[model samples]
Target: MPTLKQKPKQRPFCFSVKGHVKILRLVLTVTSMTFFIIAQAPEPYIVITGFEVTIIFFFIVLYTVRLDRLVNCVFWPLLDVINSMVAAVFMILISMLALIPETTTYIVIGGVFGLAASVFCIADGALIYRKLLFNPSGPYQKTAVHDRF
Candidate 1:
């Protein structure tokens, strides 16, 4: 029997797969954006990368603070998966665009980072999808152990 002083041990968010992916996403976003800016990439590419960086930053803070648990109205994991998938798609598109033959060295570097980010995004989405499938959460969650049949 544990005493009142012995609180349940909780794993840090940074140690989880989700957290690792999120951090990777943030790093990639910032790095690519930096390279893109330095390379003087097109306005559209810069704007798109900026938008993605903002979104990724928002999700990082949301998960880090455990706000997802507080906001019962939203299915955060699903939203995160959707965001990751969308970001991956956008990143792939922009990365391809940036990697054209006439592009500068910095642009090529940015494109490489962008491609890497997209791969990580896809991985993140897949991992979250598996988690949701195996361990359902939210209001309508029903586990096999609870079933009487």
Candidate 2:
């Protein structure tokens, strides 16, 4: 009789599939916040909100990336996807608003950063979507266990 072998489980701290996206997200978030702070814009609330959200999520992703097992939970991926989508939309809107006719150099720089962040967020969202929704054997897939009689 032939014996069936099960595939080995992935390590908990193994590199995440979304590693690149997460790093880019962190960089873009920090850059956007720094530029927004330095810019002398009339309204800083949008950037402030974006910065706060980005900081919070950045830490969450950082922690989860190190502990990949946490990502197996349904809530984490859903939250990440939704957050990325919202952040992208908000950044786009803010960037467009920041591009007024009389914008200063700093404001223009900040707007550019915001736009870049928006693009990153959108890419992250798409990657998350692929990981969660599109991939059949992804983290969310269920495996059946069999017992010999």
Candidate 3:
């Protein structure tokens, strides 16, 4: 009698490096935002507002980037590069501010999250660059068009 073979178990959620980084950024952003809001540090409303905006943007981009068809758009890679660069810079600055010696515990926690987010953003940017620009066969490469006109 032939025995039936068992199939490999499937993971409920599997993600690539880019996807993982994106998810990391999303979680860190939310954590930092919540901490900042709750900490109620005086002044510097811009930082709070920036976090709010970033949280919203990441939520949307996270969903869009997961769709392969959407990611194939000519502007998608460029947008990802720009977004990650900006986010990294912004997080670095915010983290520094959050790390002030006299800051509260919540601020310090937020700072740590911000730093993590910055690292993830930088990694995401580098990966996007590698995937879309560094490789010869990347999406941004121009192909010769032979027109019969």
Candidate 4:
């Protein structure tokens, strides 16, 4: 009989509070970008929204496969917090720009979506920050190196 090797299965991390937040971020960003396109928002606004969508999607993938654990050189949680904060700031600024008077209804809706996304981003960053601060064995902690026996 021929033998075949099988890889161990890993659990999906994208269903926790952090995971839910990331999914929400993606959904809101996508909706906002669609509305922006329909409303013909400024190029920068559309581009920034696209960037946010990409970043959020990247994090979702990273968490889904537990890649953050394998790549131990970088402090993933801190990096994620920084990303979330920056995303929130950018989203709020662009939403404000989109909510100007005389803007189309689609723009207004997009601006609202942007605002909601920003709030979630802030919440995500805060959650990660708290985890790092309060938990001594948090994800941000570096893993100990051990030699093969």
lDDT on C-alpha atoms for all candidate structures: 0.86, 0.66, 0.70, 0.89
Whose TM-score is greatest here? Answer: 1
RMSD of each: 4.4, 6.4, 7.7, 7.7
Worst 10 residues of 2 by lDDT: 11-20
Model 4 misses residue 138 by how many Å? 13
Kindly report which residue pairs in candidate 1 clash with one another.
none
Q: Largest lDDT belongs to which candidate?
A: 4
Q: Put down candidate 3 lDDT per residue, 27-113, tens digits, no spaces.
A: 777787778778885445236536545654654465454553455555666677787888788788878887876478987887888
Looking at model 3, residue 3 earns an lDDT score of 100
lDDT of 2 at 13: 22
Mark the regions of model 3 whose C-alpha exceeds 4 Å error after superposition. 1-14, 42-74, 134-149
Q: Per-prediction TM-score, please?
A: 0.82, 0.67, 0.66, 0.81
lDDT (tens digit, per residue) of candidate 4 on 1-149: 99998987744677577788789989999999999999898899899999999999888898887898899999989999999999999999999989876479999999999999999999989878876776645455555566432
Poorly placed runs, candidate 1 (over 4 Å): 1-8, 134-149
Alpha-carbon runs more than 4 Å astray in model 4 = 1-11, 134-149
Instruction: List clash counts for every candidate, in order.
Output: 0, 0, 0, 0
Span of ten consecutive residues with least summed lDDT in model 1: 134-143
